[model samples]
Target: TLENIHELALGIELAGVRFLWALRKPAGTGNDEELLPAGFEERTRLRGLVCTGWVPQVTALAHGATGAFLTHCGWGSTIESFAFGLPLVMLPFIIDTPMIARAMAKRGIGVEVARDESDGSFDRDGVAVAVRRVMVEDEGKVFATNAKKLKDLVVDEGRQEQYIHELEDHLRRNKDV
Candidate 1:
């Protein structure tokens, strides 16, 4: 997730909903506190921030009650976000983040924050606005609704089998091509 983690950590307070953030352990780069804001450290408990290396990253997304995602707009994360039916607070920080954000925005599965016209670094205020928009705004509610609808289509029991068969058939057909 992006800086929206802060707003999600705070917004749930106003709406009486429970919001949790699952932070992953660094694979190659150690704990990068520089990525998170200074004051955010206080949320170690209140936000249910879990920093662990054991569980798969997708576990949190698949868990029930995960209403939305605050993501960096990376392709893998975007696909997982859709698979989990969680609408996003899309923040594109590097490389293809902006492109993925635009695509997700078009799908009505997420909202993107305005990037700096010059440098593209997002400050705390920008992060807050984006997260609040997704977590509390009317458009955000619509996005969440649509995202869930899409998820149902993807996870439908009948369709799941059909999709698997189709994938297998396609792979077999393209074995050489």
Candidate 2:
């Protein structure tokens, strides 16, 4: 987990964009400084912030200045980002997240950071490329447009109620199966 954090720090630093990283300190680590790569704090002082405590994720996502979400593609976070019409840079690690990431990519809503085939490890370059693609590059515009479309769908109460009703009907029909 520490290794992942270190790599994330390196990657974000290399990305060289203004960032607010909500880093939960690893268990058994006493100080916040030890959780990051050496000189990372100093180097990124002007353009980056690593918060070690509770971060109000919804508030962050709602901020007008926020451009893209770098996330692990958990269902809740994914939904929240979509609700805000923020394009994503996904780095999924486990469970259904990778599948969700792939689906999102196919839908033009995000870019998944590339990982090593053997070890599934990602590096700074991959992180930078993914972030840039979703944040600054021309391709980002498409992702942004798609994200806005998704936001409309996500925030539509009528569509949500319809989905719920459909789910309930399907469950009722399949109750014995």
Candidate 3:
């Protein structure tokens, strides 16, 4: 896990884009500094902010300057990112997250960081490439457009109510089953 964190840090640094990283320190780690590569903070000080405490995720996502979300593709996080019209750079670790990541990638709203099938390990290059694809490359525009469409659907009260009603109807029809 520490190695993964280190690789993420290195990859984000290599991406060379402004970033806001909300890093929850590994359990039993004494300080945040202990979690990062040497001189990473100083090297990225001008373009990055690494917060080691609890962050207001929604607030960050809603900020106008925020470009894309680097997430683990949990349902909640995925929905939140979509609600804000933010493209995703996904690094799914477990459970249904990998499936969610794949679905989002298929929908063109995100890019999944590649990992080793044998060890499930990802490197700095993968991280940098995924970030750059969603943040710097021209392909990012397509992701942004798709994300905005998803956001519109997510924020539409009428559509939401329709979905709820549909779900209720389905449940009623299946109540006997």
Ranking by TM-score: 3, 2, 1
For residues 25-104, write the lDDT of model 1, one tens digit per residue: 33454464443445544544465454543545588789886778877788898878778888988777679888888988
> Once model 2 is optimally superposed onto the true structure by TM-score, how far is the C-alpha of residue 136 displaced, in angstroms?
1.3
Residue pairs of candidate 1 with colliding backbone atoms: none
Task: Please identify which of the two predictions, 1 or 2, would achieve the higher TM-score against the true structure.
Answer: 2
Clashing pairs for predicted structure model 2, backbone only: none
Off by over 4 Å in 1: 1-19, 22-39, 48-55, 157-177
Candidate 2 vs candidate 3: the lDDT winner is 3
Q: Over the stretch 77-125, how does candidate 2's per-residue lDDT look in tens digits?
A: 9999998999999999999999999999999998999999999999878
How many clashes would you count in candidate 2? 0
Error of 1 at 41 (Å): 2.6
Give the distance in Å from residue 22's predicted Cα in candidate 1 to where it truly belongs.
4.6
Taking all chains together, the TM-score of candidate 3 against the true structure is 0.95
Give the alpha carbon lDDT tens digit for every residue of 72-92 in model 3.
999999999988999999999
The parts of candidate 2 lying over 4 Å away from their true place are: 28-33
